[model samples]
Target chain A: MLVAGEHVLFHRARGFGRDTHGASPPTVLRHSLVKRKFFRLKLQRERTFAPVRTLYNLNLRQSGKMSEKIVLYYFDGRGKMESIRWLLAAAGVQFEEVLLTKREQYVKLLNDQALMFEQVPLVEMDGLQLVQSKAIMNYIAEKYKLSGKDLKERAMIDMYTEGLNDLMEMRMILPFKKPDEKQAHIGVIQGKATSRYFPVYEKALNNSQYLVGNQFSRADVHLMEATLMLEELFPTILSTFPNLKAFQGKMRSLPTISKFLQPGSQRKPQPDDVYVKTVMEVLNIQIP
Target chain B: MLVAGEHVLFHRARGFGRDTHGASPPTVLRHSLVKRKFFRLKLQRERTFAPVRTLYNLNLRQSGKMSEKIVLYYFDGRGKMESIRWLLAAAGVQFEEVLLTKREQYVKLLNDQALMFEQVPLVEMDGLQLVQSKAIMNYIAEKYKLSGKDLKERAMIDMYTEGLNDLMEMRMILPFKKPDEKQAHIGVIQGKATSRYFPVYEKALNNSQYLVGNQFSRADVHLMEATLMLEELFPTILSTFPNLKAFQGKMRSLPTISKFLQPGSQRKPQPDDVYVKTVMEVLNIQIP
Candidate 1:
């Protein structure tokens, strides 16, 4: 990839960790800080703002801190954007989020024709504005060589990640469940995790320490992410799944994943009531 | 791709339509039927049945007709597997289905560990047991060249298809909606189809005749399928979206897709009462 008429080097998205691909760290990214009092909408690229939303004037003191890096646009909480954050962190890619705190910010994106489906976690990378979380994850996974190397290996990785996605999606909707129905929904999640989902991952891990291509891939990243997610809901979530526990431990010890696990990293804590309020307020939705 | 120790000559997965790739037919697939008055699942593969259920004795007279090609395992309805069927048909690939009508058939597959995640839509093709509907669709799409040619093009295709899928999934769960809630759900689907989704495709189609890579792709196929689905619910679904209507016309005029649309073909009609009943029984789930 070329930038500024020169071959740009990569440092795993210019992350805090070192690139495992043997690329030195000084090619694709370099930006000087520019501070002004105006609501400048140029996010490493030039764009005119419509002034239709208060978001254009919100405190953007952090923009210069993350200049020229991948820009992720979403709310201030862990909704659909969480998994993309997880995948990028696992790939050792550093990104910054333009958090939407008000409903007008989302509407501004829609009015500018920025979001394809009028929905986000919109990511700007490689000179492209990307939407759809799965597509973004696939792109980052492939770019980082975490996606499989062959067609068959890709098939296995796709299958495992997809199954884990089904499980994660169940919890992803927990905040929307009615208060009366929350318990039963949790029961359903627990039932499906143990009976339907966790067993498959456990069995898949039994044959090899890795999920796809017998090496670390996005599937392993997802498995480790999901186990920790379930553990949040139920502390002993992996009690019956010994292999998954061991797999989670092994995944956490990887260089990239281990760095991500450390404090002061980009990983967000689990969403709380305040986080939920900000998300629902920005998206303008009521709990179902 | 090799099959049976020989370079397999492909005819677009061996269908009624001609292969546009210019490969002569007949080097991989050939099977003679063995007539036995039992539920033998030797669909071009050697596997002994334990005979633990009535599915082992159910009528399977049509298995011989679809031998040596793809074997799709699902119920006789247009559920999640419908898009896979649409993709295969659009690719002009011939496939067979082992329809499940009884709970015991599902139990048998579960006992045999055929389903990786204890779910249906399991497919047998290219000597691999493929699970996860999206994974199966991706595999088939890439094999038949409905997927795009490069990474950027593939990203575009994946993005459009993912958006279309969000719309399609809203209708897919309608079968499980409560009797009294069905009307409201239908209203939601129609509202989202017209307001949220159609405009995106309309604008996308404004730039080119195709959705990705200036060629036919799985995204186009999915948009066509989704528009037809919405039209089934609302006859005037595409009245406001001129570009989408034209795109649909262009897609439907393709030789392979037009053939699949014809009557007396392998295409299943919209699900009626019996189809829903069979699916509910086989899966053993109450309406949520």
Candidate 2:
């Protein structure tokens, strides 16, 4: 049984069945059950009359349970979850993409009492609903052995990936900038940040073929995603750093990675590019 | 020898001596050397004529070199590095605090070539000049065996700590809020976040004495720091959560932690805080 009262309610409400053993639930399940329960209570209290539903139904029919079935929840466009998607592909793991492309669906999920931090790039696996992109990615990375060879390597990967994620967050703010301010902000990024930060990546790549361990790592995946985003905005961005360019090329050519980069699967063009859509839809504001 | 050009310059500039083996420097040493070197180059490039100095001088006189000595560079205030300081205290490790209280000294370190991300809470240990508080904390946690008993425990600790850290980040923005907006923001936090987040902690504490593995952890330390900060601002904040209050009391009762809480070693009041003084002094701006 879970310690939190609301979690107990959530598990019962979600119809979360017994754990894999059917005798004793895992500790993670207790954590998840409580979190979802707590969130559900908050939702019910805040919007008493509104019909709010959990994002995903508790599917207890899978043979392997949480271990076998991986569900990723994110907006329709490939934004924060793209690298995660790439990681799944690279790891050769099959997953269910529960892309909440519609405004209504997003609102519903936002109101869902199960969302920790009330944000996405949430992942459901192994009987737990893990929130926070970094935490989710780390879980996947650890499970798939993509973290690194040793603890030190893992820490290095975490460090590099953290830096890359920070850069991604900076980019996420671009679409929200006013038209007048957008150009100037972009100028600083393209002119100054690209030169300052990219060379750092280029230098890292020069030392090892990959970012962290000379082996493919979550850091490389994160860096590759950043490179794709930046290059999409400014095509000639990577031209100055040959090592990074080559590194980008190498990452893009990975058979698993290449599949995701195909025109059909590639990220949609901006404007409604996830974050912008999130703000516009969430705020009910018309982005000009 | 380190691979990066600037790092080589940095190590030489910092007067870093070769490790005991004297063949190739350790990985952490190389990492520190490169970070310092890279930051130094950036400082030099940006402020060509400015007098840029390193954050801390090379102290290789210690018998064990980097392995033995630990240096934490931050403003005297218990800001981002507070949790780290607590961790070191809890670990009972001796560390040197190079508090950048002087404006010229702080500015010099800020403009130092080795300060990556150009931010503080920089740590020097194990021959690595680690930037980013989170990274440094994780490193220390791992090194000190305070992370968790195993990977699963570590992940759980990470998940809980991540939630706590997110909350901490939210509180960090409180100081900048205008008076008019402050109350509304505090209302949301006290009413919504406290009700939602605190119960989880309460439940966790109810289940076990510690946040993770029923043993002392970095997560508990971080939570303690957050609790202290929150209680400092809103004295009656934890009155509703008896379990958390008890947990805080238990944590405070720890001898090492108690020592840190003692008034003499306590952080001084802000505005004329260390980092602010550094900036005002460095820029020669008159503080009202």
Candidate 3:
């Protein structure tokens, strides 16, 4: 399901001893690009950096192998894919991206029937072409068992996640806003977060450590990702909500999430001018 | 969470004996609204609108009773609440809508912290205040076992539902379009449905009786809803897609769905000028 020759595995291993999680020692998943064929991976013990060895290029879903990498299809920015990236990272799942750089690159995907709605942030996982940010996250969360234990808990998680998504969406479109209007847009995000959205989360955190259910779930992961995004915009965004502040620290300290925060991880930076311009040109559309 | 004084159960009985499913005879659920308190309902055999008697003023969630009606909070329109109405109707689950007419009504809900993101289409069910249309729909679908039985099936259902939602959203905004520009908007919908969306569903239907799993699921319900929506715009919208054409007919024949499609049911009409004006004033914002 990958656009040929455009695959690059966003490996978590910063080539050797990085942030190690509990219990299992980290194994490096090194993937080599094979055009529209199969995903080849070599599992190297930490700091091995062995010769380019080829192991089974097995289908992750077909083999029911949790260790194999997932493929993400999207443009080279953080519009919709950022949350997908967040969930995957939180699950400690390694993934590769087919970053569409040209209009033709995106259109080929359309012609291939790879995108259900002709939109990106499509993840090829468990033998399915996953689209829609919420759907993608829901699948990943359920796969990782971050979605709750029962139907009611999952429902609560979905509700809280949806609310956090509303807040994240306000910040997500900032890069697309006109430069002259950017400050006003930031003001809106700050105001909404402080007066409305943050207060809700703050109150929820007061009752439980996680947003939904007693354990960490998709809602908590989303809140953490959103918290980091908001912090990047205004460093003091969570200053008034002490619960959120403490929640932010606790979230950053999670083993998988902490690894994602490192310097060379797959997390894309805020949309720079070039990234935004490229997105505008490649999509050839304007968001109203 | 039944808001005081505004609860009216939308029962599907055209006074009983209307449409029967399988071997099970239809029973009538009659509701009487109580101010600020509880939902009181009486169960009667078909054709009996018995004298008002008080049953348990049940909290539907805590009592684990599925027969009790769910309460929906939204403006009296088919904006985001329409899909909800569709799912509930398809499940044969009766619901009451607290339709907001004034700006202060919505503002009061905000002040009361009923709306997590300051938006409506909130459903008060199972002792929880649920916001966000997708979350609410997912909860309902899962609770009614309309969502797929397994993770992969659920994922596929989610993916298909998301695609259909994209198409529905395009039509959803038409009510807000300028009166002079309405035709152009309709044209856009027709073009997108025939070109981008309908074909996908048509192809998916070509594969199975249902969109995701072997049985009826949320995706199937959404497709049925969207098909009805598109047909309203252009009668021949599905003429080119035989699978979808057949799918629509098959879906409407199901007992619950057949009842929902009946006239005098809770299915909302396309938003009128008054609905649009109230939405604009009550929300007090402009989209882009």
TM-score for chain A, candidates 1 onward in order: 0.76, 0.71, 0.74
Model 3 per-residue lDDT tens digits across residues A165-251: 666766665665556556755775676577556887899899578887688888888999888889998898788889998998888
Cα lDDT tens digits for candidate 1, B56-86: 3222322333234577777776776889899
Q: Which stretches of candidate 2 lie over 4 Å from their true place?
A: A1-56, A59-67, A102-112, A266-275, A278-288, B1-56, B59-67, B102-112, B178-181, B266-288
- Per-residue lDDT of model 2, residues A138-237, tens digit only: 7788888898887677667766666665556445545544555557546544643353457568878876788877689888888888887888789988
Candidate numbers, best DockQ first, in rank order: 3, 1, 2
RMSD of each: 14.7, 12.5, 13.9
* Selected candidate, larger TM-score, 1 vs 2: 1
Q: lDDT of all the models against the reference?
A: 0.63, 0.56, 0.63
After superposition, the stretches of candidate 3 with alpha carbons farther than 4 Å from their true spots are A1-68, A286-288, B1-68, B284-288
What TM-score does each of the candidates earn? 0.77, 0.74, 0.77
lDDT of 1 by residue, A1-288 (tens): 111001111112211110111122111110111111121343333232321222332223224332345777776556677778888888888777776765555555555556676567787776666888888887888888887888788888988888887677667656544465468557756766776679888888886899876688999988888999999999998999999999988888888889888997767677677776776555444332
DockQ of each: 0.16, 0.11, 0.19
Q: Compared with the true structure, what per-residue lDDT tens digits does model 2 show for residues B126-151?
A: 76767666677788888888888876
Residue-wise lDDT of candidate 3 within B89-132, one digit each (tens)? 98989887666665455554554456666567778777777887
lDDT for position B39 in model 1: 23
lDDT of 3 at B72: 75
